[model samples]
Target chain A: MKKLFFLIGMTFFFSSCEKEGVLTKGSNPIPTINNTAVLKYSGTFVPTSGITVQGNVNIYAQGNKYQLQIENITITDGPDLKVYLSKSDTPSSFVNLGNFKGNGTSVYDIPAQVDVSEYPYVLIHCQQYNHLFAIAELISKQSN
Target chain B: MKNKLKKALLFSTLFILGYTANAQGCSDAGFCSVGNTFKDAQSEIKNSIEIGGVYGVGEEDVTVFSPYAIYTRIFTNRFAMSAKLTATTANGSFGTISNLGDVFVTGNYKFNTGDYDKSKWSGILGVKIPLTASNDKINNFSLPMPYQSSLGTFDVITGLDLAIKKWEFSTAVQIPLNQNKNSYLSQLAPTDKFDSTNLLERKSDVLFRATYKIKTENQKFIFRPNVLFIYHLGKDSFENVFGQRQTIQNSEGLTINGNLITSYRLSEKNYIEASIATPFVVREVRPDGLTRAFTIGLSYKRNF
Candidate 1:
């Protein structure tokens, strides 16, 4: 048994780098929406205390897919933060976009099952502590 | 008044001891591993080896396949030593990663109580060494907690096992001895500004199990049905994907499981054992990337 363990240890030690699916710090480019997309609604971010958060949220429609583009975003870095489209800053009513990638321009696809038309707010929330960091309420840009 | 109080206390202690003696080990592996009685072959066989595989499937299309080996040696009638090693491969929506898992070494001491039942008790002490760093990542996103092969912490485990007649009862506790500093905050993008220290804190776990064994008429086979209850005292803390240190919610929960354990003796020196366990209740919230619903395993044991 000791000999078998020793053999296994030597094998792993020699082949550590050769192991498949090892974690790497590879880069994943931020997703982008097409230029042909039409802007449906837009909003300016409302900052909350503790972080200077400012950004423009543009909801664009291209065929059947809707893209939520966050532009010129600046927020003090936070832990466990996430982006969401919701009726309020609370998570129960929110549709999770994903974890905050960083303070920058990024686009996320709206799932087909989600009705972005009804959820008018974009919220930055700390999922670990359930703290709302910032919120942006979308308003119609069209001249009614 | 003093005599009455003494009598009350004595009665309570007796009742509690009687209750505990009726409960035995379970299949959770956490408790059952330390609390098991491998029978009276301890004097005849110097060593026993076990090889097995476990598979688990859960929500979000996550799956885990683990193959493991165990070696145990009885140094004397009252003393034994055991070690286990495992490798795990996990795959799901988060991607795939495979690596060596935790390694454990344990020492046990067996003694007898001078009573009518002549019951036996075993005390166990062990340690789990991390074989893989818990902060493993995929494409720069720290792989969710479940994808990591090791919990990234050394754990101290201790427990007690009791055997009387055809019943066995066991309980054990596993506590992390150190914080894993390599837990990278994957939720935060690399560009995100956050604290430099990314540590993951794990909670302690407790298990209680009881089993009743029924032997065949010829005594060549044995069937043991067991029930296990596990509690995760969920105070797990880690830097979130957003780079904030906080406790992961829905982590604390209780699970109840039923297991059917069967062993068939091929000879005096060899046996085949199979066990299937299904969780009847899950009461806590698990992380987004990992889920555990059922576990199954089979192993061959050989004594030398």
Candidate 2:
């Protein structure tokens, strides 16, 4: 009986130690942009203290609809990271673009209700830990 | 016996009237079914085994099926113990996942009421043990609580039940001892309609149930209709990306459900039961993902 109990205990222990799922780094290609797509604003990513980030962010307007694009970007991989269009560098008042795909040239559609002009800064943040990884202050192409 | 039956009927009518007049709502995370709280009323057998399963549609139209087994041993007329194990399978847009759920070990003590036929009271204490860490994931993304088999917290459960003839009334509470290590972030699964469950901290819950039983002339068949109320003690909390705890608003509220169970005795020691339950009221937010639109179950019991 003791041996049988020990065997059952060991089996349970090993089963409980099964591997958990882990996220891996990947890349996505930038969306196609035609001549009709005009640049509205652009900025370069600036890393937070002790972090590494290199990227250029651009907002384009095709008619009234808008899209945000990140090009040639390299960022520190983190858990639950997201891209945000924020009123300030902090994520207090912001619209979540979605999860930040690693080292990506990726595109995100801006909601029609969101006034991009009011959201002057773009951020890469860890939503779970509330850590800011990178910030980019948009400069309007028309203003420049 | 005639007087006892009349008193039970009167009490049952009064209780139903009061319940309907001042009723709220709530949900269950497993404590309500522990021990002998809802088992076949006091049997003369010293030992028994039960096997059962439930099928239900949960949050976001996820189909959930759970199969369980329970073993009970009566040490004396006053004391008994039960152990239950359950396994769950959930299928939804995210995918299919199945695993061993939680184990509940409960001890029940029937109080000495000199007149056992008039009224009997029992107290129950139990502990829920999780079989898996609540971090099951699909495609490297953590699945929400609805998809995971276990809530992944050690919980203490305690309750009291009073039975008078054909009516039974019970109240119970379940308290979590620790937070689960689930790291589900809604942002990662933008298309899914689930809330963030990262390191979810569930609040305590209290529940009350009133059941009335009816039996056939031969006593071969029994039917019970129950009204259940559960209240989440407070808002649940979850750890954010910044490693700070944030309250999940609207997580605490009441849910009310109506349940009907029918049982048939195949022999002196063998029985079968079928049950159906539906929620009449639900909380605004249920981040812990225990919501069920409806549940239907069947079980077999054998007494020795």
Candidate 3:
């Protein structure tokens, strides 16, 4: 019985330290952008309903292309969530920036045809429920 | 101030209604009887059944209700078999509810030292079956871990129990045997298969408990006070749709609790028990949604 107890204790000690290898490590590292920012707008996310959503969104114009960068943001987990550059705070008249990933620092491509200056709000909208969880009003940071 | 008064009134009402109980507390296997059930020969009390319910309010405004039925039968004076079925309903203030938790079975072997008339030691082995179906959804997306009933993993439970005089002490370990591929995802695609690499891995847990029971001269009313310490030794891991595993930083921690248990013996064959526990020590990042605060439970048992 003593030996069996010792064996069981040892097994628990070792198994507790067993850590599995993560399949995707550093897979979403921020890419280096060579183009300098010609026009920039920055804002922080504000939660509307449900879980708390907090993050900073930076809209940078690099020559003809634009980038929508979300940094240090934690969003309330939701379904069919999408990121949008909206004309106003509401979900109407918004340019869909595709799916909104979970809270973290990530970047998305912004279409050049869409006027970033006109649509000054970054909205984390739940597409399934047609609800706006959070909104970030972009303010002019710099314009070259 | 109003909420506190309401809470006090609710607790008092529940306490008065609860009279009988088994050892089911916050964690599983509430009683820590190491050597309390030893018999010299085949006794008349060979079979017993207990029915109980537990209510818990955790962090993140989560409420849990668990109702269980347990049956135990002694084959001889030293061997016993027990089976338990538990139904759980978890509700998140964020509007998520899950029902039907896991069902488990346990087998125990008792051993006594000195004489059969004295207290003895025993070992318990058990397995939990996660046959509960989890289909809870919110806004067309599968509910997160907090609103789901089961971890969807098969777990093994092993423990030791000792009862001597007025004191009872026991320790137990529960470990998951495999990672369960969870179908619940926040933003899963329609084409995504249920067998996707999205998995939930649970960590092993160690529980230590001690209880002292004081009975009246006639033994009609029993008062048992106990303390429980539970350590989550394993890290809860989550595998995303991309098959990348991330350790949920908040799911592993230590909890220390103390509770007063009371029982009333209505007759020789029937009894009632109840317990209320509050956590005095908590060290860990609590998993999102599921919060742990106080627990109340009541049970009725009959022996034949």
Candidate 4:
């Protein structure tokens, strides 16, 4: 046991610099959305808008027994969209909207009364700068 | 009263010892490195910063400097026992940092992190080594330093921690118990010995630590933010210098502070780390005279 610990320690010591991710994405989705693509959706859609367009996508996340669902989103002129959720929205720092590989419609089933009161709206911001692009509103409340 | 305190501690011990005698340590390394969530077989924190800063209350002109060394021994899958030995070097009298150089050995067992991570839960039992250094800066920084020391000090530490992803949260308390009253009486004044009935008497410390970090895969660049908190009371709180009321330590209430530690792994054997600590909330007065500074140092790890 001691020998094994020594070997592991030696490896870690020699390889501290060679290591990569400080934290691994626990579980990732398929066809992940390019953070930039999502940020392009502005509530007010227009042709010559500086940001690109991708509209009406579903969002979902189920950690343990809790479930969250974002029905649909629309793009406007710019990449930043603004939507105000109903009074009952639980804001969460680690929110998972659905996957967005190329671009298509996505849906998520929300549990009956999962408490998502914190993050009332989802800010689809550029992944790089994390700038707020599109804002989402919560209209329905449910539990599973 | 002393017996009651002793019995209280002993009962707590038996309840823990009796139930866990058969249980073993946790998975991975021991105690899960209170500052970090990951565990490795061959482990050495080498040097991890205490992320939080401290804000002191009560008294004034009180300043202190203390450094600590702690180690955890993994016993089994569900629990780990540990010990901490520290040396406190003070800069001023009473009003500032009070407790110094307390050598204590404690046993700790963990509980949570049920399935995913098992290193978070922990219960502690330990003792502090006492000293009668009258010249103690905290008591009388002007008097010189304490050479007369007490060998045995019964202290207790109870703590728990939870780590998820990039964050860690924990709280702990250290209480001094059992004593060599004769030891103090022999060196100082007769009335100076243990107050006898004051089992909960004398000195005790309470602290909290929390940290968040982002590490690179190559282990090259790592940044961690943390906080440290301390609360002192009893003989540990009072420092009398040559019949003069020198200072009133961290006796007031709570002190909150934070630290940012950036470490770069230069090579397999040599790593450089810089820690910058800040005092966020000052309950009483502004922090002065001290570094309010950054600690930059290098550490070498060798598997021998």
Q: Which model scores highest in lDDT?
A: 2
B89 in model 2: Cα distance from truth in Å? 0.8
Query: lDDT tens digits, residues B88-189, model 2?
Result: 777776667777889999899988553636888889999999986687765445678888888889999999998888888989999999888687767545
DockQ of the two-chain complex in candidate 4: 0.00
Q: What is the full ranking by lDDT, best candidate first?
A: 2, 1, 3, 4
Candidate ordering by DockQ (highest first): 2, 1, 3, 4
Superposition error at B278 for model 3 (Å): 1.7
Q: For candidate 1, what is the DockQ-based docking class?
A: incorrect
On a 0 to 100 scale, what is the lDDT of residue A117 in model 1?
Answer: 77
How does model 1 score on DockQ? 0.07
| Candidate 4 chain B lowest-lDDT run of ten | B23-32
Over 4 Å off, model 2: A1-144, B1-29, B35-44, B113-117
Kindly indicate the candidate among 1 and 4 with the higher lDDT: 1
lDDT (10s digit) by residue, model 3, range A23-83: 1123324344446765488899999956697789988777788888888999888766778
Interface CA RMSD of each prediction in angstroms: 8.2, 7.3, 14.4, 25.5
lDDT (Cα, tens digit) per residue for candidate 1, span A46-131: 87777788888899888878889889899987766667888765555766666566777988777776777788898888654568
Please list the C-alpha lDDT of all candidates, in the order they appear. 0.68, 0.77, 0.64, 0.36
Question: What does candidate 3 score in Cα RMSD to the true structure?
Answer: 16.0
| Chain B TM-score list for all models | 0.80, 0.88, 0.79, 0.50
Off by over 4 Å in 4: A1-144, B1-100, B112-120, B131-154, B178-203, B231-250, B265-273, B283-304
lDDT digits (tens) for residues A1-144 of candidate 2 = 345335434433433322222222122233456578989999999999879999999999888888999889999887667788889988787877766756869787777777889999999987656799999999999863
Model 3: lDDT of residue B243: 30
Tens-digit per-residue lDDT, B30-115, candidate 4: 11123232232134433221111122111122222333334445455444444443333232222222333344454545565454
> After TM-score superposition, what is the CA distance of residue B96 in candidate 1 from its true location, in Å?
2.7
TM-score of chain B of 4: 0.50
